[model samples]
Target chain A: MSAMAARSPFRTDGTWLLVGPAVIFLMLFFIYPFGYGFWLSFNPAEGAWSANYQKFFSDEHLWRTLIVTFQLSLPVTILNVGLALPIAFQLRRKTRYQRWVTTLLVIPITLGTVLIAEGMLTYFGPRGWLSQFLQLLHIYDGPIRLTHNFTGVVLSLVISGFPFAFLLTLSYVTGIDPTLARAAATLGAGPWDQFRHIYLPLLAPGLAITFCLAFVQAFSVFPSAVLVGAPSGPTRVISLAAYEAAFEQYDYSMASAVAMIMGFAQLIVVVAVLGLRRGLYRGPVGGGKG
Target chain B: MSAPSERRHWFYSVWSGLLLGLMAFFILNIGLMVAAVVTNSFGRRWLGTWLPEGYTTQWYAAAWKEFQLGDVLWVTAEVVLVVVALSIIIGVPAAYALARRQFRGKQLVMLLFILPLIIPPITYGIPMATVMYQAHLGGTLSGVILSNLVPALPFVILVMTPFIEQIDPTLESAARVFGANTLRIFWHVLIPLLMPGILAASLLVLVRTIAMFELTFLTAGPDSQTLVVALYYAVFAAGVRAPQSVDAMAMVYMAATLVWLLIALRFVNPTQLVSRVKEQPAH
Candidate 1:
């Protein structure tokens, strides 16, 4: 390929010419923006100082918002992974039902967060069918108030995020050789024993990676928060707080601070999850090394 | 012994049933969302019912006439086309080099490509907007196209790398040995074989660029507003002059995206598109 490109009438330097411009383009657009964000986080305005950082830490609402962000993220991550595992296993069987289910599940990924929130409003919201049915049954008298609260926000996050986790887990599960499970079964292992001994251990790494990926995705929740309702009580995630600070309050300094904190928190969580996975691998290998 | 085998069979059946049940639940959840979107688009303001009381094509009509949906659709198509074309022009060769050639800073180059995927858009948008504004690119179609290159470039490279790697080097060597020269080899040999990957990458880039909201929202001005940005403004800033209008606009947006996705789907392999780019040594 290199030799062919060198001899081409389009010029031998085609590769460099084609690749260099895009690389430089990304450097200017992607790299510079990231560096600028980091610099803004520290500089806080005209001078190089930690005032934004200090203020972010000192402000009570910042901490509360951070906690709320975690509150929304942690549970959604757990639920998405928990739900994805069984679906992934069944998908490995490759039944006709699995194909239809996989296609149906992927619809949300294509649907933007705004659209998903809108759908939730019409279907799961107070005035929507779910609430109406509950009321008709006398389970509740008033609107269910699913939107504008922790439950609504988390549910939105979970619904939107579950597909991604499930797809990733499904791919990982399918990648594992089925022979291992069959071997375990033939060795007089019960179904539960075969799963616990052969399957879960192999799946642990993929699950850990999926957990972090899902957490990052859920952590960056934005349009859903705004469209569903402002993250006031339990829904006010860090991204919402950052956007509000920057756009609504016109406090770029504070906004940058919140964004920095959010990024840092996500990095920590990802690193910790990855670290735990590494720790798992470094442990004494049981009878099943593969 | 027979009793124990029967009991085990029953347990497995129940377990499989539960798995199938969960799968059904997931399918129903998504099915309901799609149904709600379609129904709400045409449904009369049906309160206190599982299904709409009445349906009409009025929303579609209003979307086309009152909303200026055609203009917004054109803008979205134009942006996606330019972004995808520019990305392919820049990405395919770079991916070929990264995959087929050994060079310095290869790892760093690959890392730089993947950077956009790592950082959240919110982190990049503010500074990107600020930079683009200073560069006189902000609020223009050019600005949106340029900012979009960050994600599009990485995606193309990631998708194209593996495709390029899978191309056997022997064919290129044979072309060279026959004195066909390099450009001829690339044009006749490499490009044709890599057509599927390129098409897939182009389609993926187009789909992504059209659906993008945050970067366009931050960088695009009123004059250059894409469909998604327009929909956002209509929903949030412009009070639904008619609530049904919002539904109409959303239906248009969804239909437009689905069409683009379907068109793009024909050119790309779904499995290969999702994986990231990794460098392999050339023999």
Candidate 2:
């Protein structure tokens, strides 16, 4: 080390003091509770260290909630990301009306899950406007069962999740330099070729990140799964399992166990998506922010 | 990328038209859903009818009286304000430090900030609530504020780091060279430059904390319930009250969020919310 460096207190400088309060706060609140929860999950009220895991895996009813959650979240994530890509791609170019459209789409996100559930129950209910309109128009006279089921929960997820997916995807789509496509066009390449050879590779990493985020948001479905879904039936997601264990049955250890498992499940999907992203083209995300 | 009209193919126009129609249909459904809630909140006895038999504002009055909305709104305001202020106080400095320094274990600190964001709240909310109860802070306003800070603080740091990095570091150095202490430099030189970012972060946090559900829900008590949590309870505890009243309550919650959301949008782009995911270290 140089004599100047040896004498200077780089690590203990006053600048580092700026970060001290936040680090201490996170340790006391965030990391400490996470570690404490992990330890607590193992030491159940009465049983062996592995009892919660044993019970969770062995009981078909308990473990099945994990599968149910995956069923809901996976599809919702795919749907949100898939639908968002096309729309966002189309809207990638700067326009006078773009902000207004984005703002309109953001309403569902600001409205939160509970409001969406409440709105779904009334608007998509059997006696709701949708049913009456369909019946009057003779589009389909059969019964319309949207609420109190898996489908209702999916609808709520889409309403809330789509805007998020759309915005993120829009940012990615807009980041690509449009001139690349135009350059390809000048070389006699068609739109499909330009997109396939250029845009797709650049978009892959962003899409993977988008998918992971959307999946994580959808995976922890609590309020919608209850308000608009059959809580005891198809929509008994993992978060619901944890909520019931903690709040309903008053078992904090079991709840922590369930919550840990929930985090583990989300981590698996995120890891898989990010791992996939590793192989994709990684250039500067924005093409000069044009 | 807009092609000249004469050069645009007919097929392309048709496809664009179809896409426009689809967008309209989706927005229409969302509009109808919100309209349905607003209509139901004011409607009288009507079932299986295109319109309600009549409309009245009694439900709003009933919801206000029965749900103790006054208390809920007050609690929501307190929680949102305190969380915003605390997050800013703690987050801005950390953001500045991270932006300006190259310390050991920087990746670990970045990871610490990112985890709370990518990990869904329910996963940590349960454990945090458990610890809060153990500490005798659960079911209180403080617990709600603390739990919310977990996400809000990281958010402020992530958003502000980029902002801080954009500011020329020489400004700080110049202030120091003039014999100004750290506090003096921050107060006079940095704060003015950081005011825009601070405003944007606080506004976004305000909107988020008002709408945050899982954290506040897991930690709050009857008296500490925010509007969103209270709205959840109003719907969750079924058969004890009128649906219209609950809808009315939902409307009130929507209005609160909508007002802040509009104000937030004026200051911050909506896309900036999740675009920070791109800022994660590539390693």
Candidate 3:
């Protein structure tokens, strides 16, 4: 025990040897590329001052995708967070099914957006299962409009986002001791009352954080939008705009500009959400600080 | 918390029922969609019907032939294996240094790891692709591997840090007192102790790398495309392939990921991930 003070306060030698490889690799590939992208956005090939940014903002079509992207992302964020809260609340008990239930709910997260899009096209397509079931029940005469539009994109986002939201929400919900709720109950706090006064305040910070995360995820959506939604129509989000600008239009600067816009939009909303969290009644941080 | 003596409002029961219904709806939705894909892949003809008319194995065979899936699967394996192996070699030691050491700039380094994770890959993928293209490395397999390594290595470090932190340092010190050098101690003492953590971390990296699309989509050449990228082309590219074949290809991608997912789940609970564990689940 006395020798503990004799050892170097930090680590034995070879600490750099351990951490150096990751630092070098990420600095070159991840950090450098990011800085390069930012630099490239500002320094365009044969352009005037901030031409790409100006061009992106000036073009009505390119900038509008930001609005369109938000429209889709906001609702999906609300639905995912809103739905996740109650479900996570309900599942906070130490029931035997908790492990399996949590595992099953998060299955879609592993499935990825592309696979979900594939499933949606089949289950929601004109000749897909949902349409056939509805038709057989005489719900409508014509085929249902599912994919190739806003509806399919939102649905896919929820399918992917809800699980993640639930996981976060559950961790927050479980972090609070059940005894607190019981204490509130003995004091005549009903479920709604307990939730509003106790759970909501504590969960608010986590919820705000969760919404920001889910919103960013939906905001950056590209695969599902292209795979299941009409790219030329209502579902033309910013990522797609960026992809086209880079890959299709062969305009790297414009693409980087759009990409920067996407990152900025996400950052603004995240900061706002976090700002709201700051003003709220902060509850105890629990679970894994995951 | 359920109280038998308490009387509940009618609305409470209905609310509880609705919540249950929502969970059921999601479960059924996921199951039905997966079932639809699986069945459609095997169905001989799936027109406007609740179930496919009949089933066969032809589509799997057809998808394999039409998509050049043999090559695609080979590429997928190559990319996933290289990323996982390299991530471990680099990340585990970093995790060790982090778990055992306290030093200046440690918090900053941790935040650096978190940044790649919190930010969407597309925000950075485009720029990376631009750099690769300019350097004539964009379409190469090495480019794809390096780009994917950005997130994978950070993920490895973050996940392994906690795992390493849990093991006692005294054991390593005891080994050191016995005259074991760094290499011998790491091989004989540290490796066995860290084996489970290593397995979980590796499997997670494998699953993640296989399903990762954004970076791979950006950097992969035609020959280096993984199955997910190939599936995207099969759907959106200049082709009018059979629906069954596409479904089969999607199924293959799904299976490839799901198997690794299942194995990873066995080693690590997904719930225990993304956040550190404060308490284990109560039975």
> What tens-digit string does per-residue lDDT give for candidate 1 at B122-210?
66777677677778998898998888888888888888888888889999889988987656877899899988778877877776777
lDDT of each: 0.73, 0.87, 0.84
The CAPRI quality class of candidate 1 comes to acceptable
Give the TM-score of candidate 1 (chain A): 0.87
Ranking by DockQ: 2, 3, 1
Q: Please provide, for model 2 over A106-132, each residue's C-alpha lDDT reduced to its tens digit, 9 standing for 90 to 100.
A: 888888899999999889999899999
Q: Rank candidates, lDDT, best first.
A: 2, 3, 1
Instruction: Name the better of 1 and 3 by TM-score.
Output: 3
True contacts kept of each: 0.37, 0.68, 0.59
Question: TM-score, B chain, candidate 1?
Answer: 0.86
Checking candidate 1 for backbone clashes, the offending pairs are A4-B182, A7-B182, A7-B183, A8-B182, A8-B183, A231-A235, A231-A236
Poorest 10 consecutive residues by lDDT, candidate 2 chain A: A1-10
Task: Give the distance in Å from residue A174's predicted Cα in candidate 2 to where it truly belongs.
Answer: 1.3
- Candidate 3's displacement at residue A271, Å, is 0.3
> After superposition, which runs of candidate 1 have C-alpha atoms over 4 Å from their true positions?
A1-15, A46-48, A136-141, A249-253, A283-290, B1-9, B180-182, B237-239, B264-283
Q: DockQ, per-model, please?
A: 0.36, 0.58, 0.56
